[model samples]
Target: MKRDVADFWNLLWEATLGLCALFALLNLFAPPQDLPWVPLDLNRPIGSATGTKVAAFDIARTAAPDQVEATTEACMAALRGADVQVERAEDTDDGGFCQVRGAVRITGGDVTPLSPSVVMTCPLAVRYVLWDRQVLRPAATEVMGSDVARVDNLGTYSCRRVYGSVDASARPSEHARANALDVAGLTLEDGRKVTLLGDWDGAGPAGGDGAVLLKRLRDGACRVFSTVLTPDYNDAHKDHFHLDAASYRLCATGPSRTRRAAADSESG
Candidate 1:
């Protein structure tokens, strides 16, 4: 009888130990998230999100409905002031104002024929020209020793969530609203291609100026666009620079120069 009781207790102890180990492994691999660690009453208001508002496009000031309309007018006026020449595309009868409002066909800028003459929102078209004038040309001249022929872009508008991410709760991407542009890289008048894939670290021979150009251009964009996502942001942005006039200035902090240096050191 005594031996049987001892065996039963030993089995129970081993089972409990196994359960504890399993729980630890699960915690290490997939800790629970999206749960209220602090319990709250369901009936009470949980209020707004909590975090530091660091993005440049974000504003602490809230706008009334009337103010929103007025602000839209002001932004259009600013686009005109920038001399962003655009032709109005025929408005589609789509029941929503989102597709028609501020939509324009960008013909060209100081350069000429924005390649495909993409149809996008006036705000984005205007900002693209601004970036070309203020950031792209100078960055090229300073770093690449040539005038930029044209700013090569992937496109401006898409009607989907970010990268078509499967996250159901993810907010609509700025691309969905025609409020963003993806810059593939710059084109020099001499026909040399400066791509993020090949030249972001610096172009030319090792320690050459082309390599540094990518970093300077990225830093310049931080002051020009609300959100300037670079390769530093993630692998998703490794091929091109994503720029937007969204409500936040999210310029990834590190440059490709530092990235390459770290990689070289690790391998060495």
Candidate 2:
């Protein structure tokens, strides 16, 4: 009886030791399981200009001070004369993109007319031309008829390559870096919706407003962005407008009267 009791205790000890070893090994080699989720709430309003929050995983852990300052300045400029309140700034790498997240409030716009609402995420150092400058400001003054609201986006921050290239599959895209944006359509405060793919060629109910607005926006984009691709350029951009800050020569391949004239003269 004494021998059996001793043997049983020894076996229990050995099993406990083995279980501890197994747990350690699993911890050392297993991938992390507590991945964080990115915040997508863009509707919250910020009350202060400077504050701090736990940095999101999508932001870089380390960012150059100049880069951060440039991004902040660009965002402020985009807001124009609106009262902007920046809540917090942090660097993180959440969605495989180098990004910065801070809450912002944009005031003084005609549509919605809210005060100090939160802006979720914007590209760093990439200045965004307001929807007015991109679409409405360029539209025929007569066509707008004094309706102020305009613009729609097809989401941003994609992880794929430029048009999904496999060979020479370079680093991730500008959207991944928060350096690119895609504009899809526009809407007026009077409830008119103008889409890029659907209404760009007078296919919507806006009576050619969509086509006119898209052309104007693309033309302005060529002036603002180093790389601008649109539906008229090729099949790769059949659905949306691609705008990026790459340092390449400005190429306006969209349906521009200036481009057509230049082509005609070169051919003539």
Candidate 3:
């Protein structure tokens, strides 16, 4: 009986130690960007589209083709479930890696409408909704004390190479595959406009509502987008936040280098 009790205690201690090790590793190797630190406003009203949905897990880039197709379906269903208004777009293969397997053009969500409708892969659209619902609206309310009425997207899909890369032979950009978006500004319910051009960094930081709102937006975008390039990232991105669902991750913020050409072009 003593031996049995001793064995039980040993197992218990081992379990505790294992848990501690896991937590320690999590603390050590966790991503530098943690969005959960900023809580969302659950009280904010959402639109009514209909259907129940489950949370999504990332579809691995190295997954089997079958898994990729199924994940695409699941993401589409999840968007409909969440009540995001999406229209299926035709398959686009601009050769190379610039193919859009399952693209969509989003019109609106439950309570919000995307102005100058953005188009992209269904998965990318779903990510947009996640950011809009989880971060954008709440962040707006938290920082500016107003609800977002319209989102002015710079755009999503564009048949072009990487925007700010100096290499002429650089690979096709996520925009080419409809896997990215460029956000221009947000219009609040109170008729206030929060934009990247008029607000980013010192331009908006002093006593400007646009700057504070832009800061919140940039941080929130970092949480949702795998690669978030801002006015701080490069001159080509000074007027818009370039967000993408790339396999790799990036979160950079700083003054952008000046460009001789206009940054509004999709390939800028």
Best by lDDT: 3
Tens-place lDDT digits, model 3, residues 1-268: 9999999999999999999997777657753223232222222222121101112434544557577567667777667766766676776765555677666676666746778876677767766776787778888888788999998887777777886465768987888777888888888998978778777754553236567778777777776677888877766887888888887889875534444234545465
Candidate 2 local lDDT, 87-150, one digit each (tens): 3433335664444343233344433221122233443222233334334454634465545454
Better of 1 and 3 by TM-score: 3
- Model 3 misses residue 24 by how many Å? 21
Output the lDDT of residue 258, model 2. 46
Name model 2 segments beyond 4 Å from true.
Answer: 1-91, 94-126, 138-141, 146-150, 166-168, 255-268
What lDDT would each prediction earn against the true structure? 0.60, 0.51, 0.68
Q: Residue 238, candidate 1: how far off, in angstroms? A: 0.9
lDDT of 1 by residue, 2-60 (tens): 99999999999999999989777755664232122222111122111101111211212
Rank by TM-score, descending? 3, 1, 2
Clashes of each: 10, 8, 4
Name the Cα RMSD for model 2.
20.0
| Model 2 CA lDDT for position 3 | 100
TM-score of 3: 0.68
User: lDDT of model 1 at residue 20?
Assistant: 89
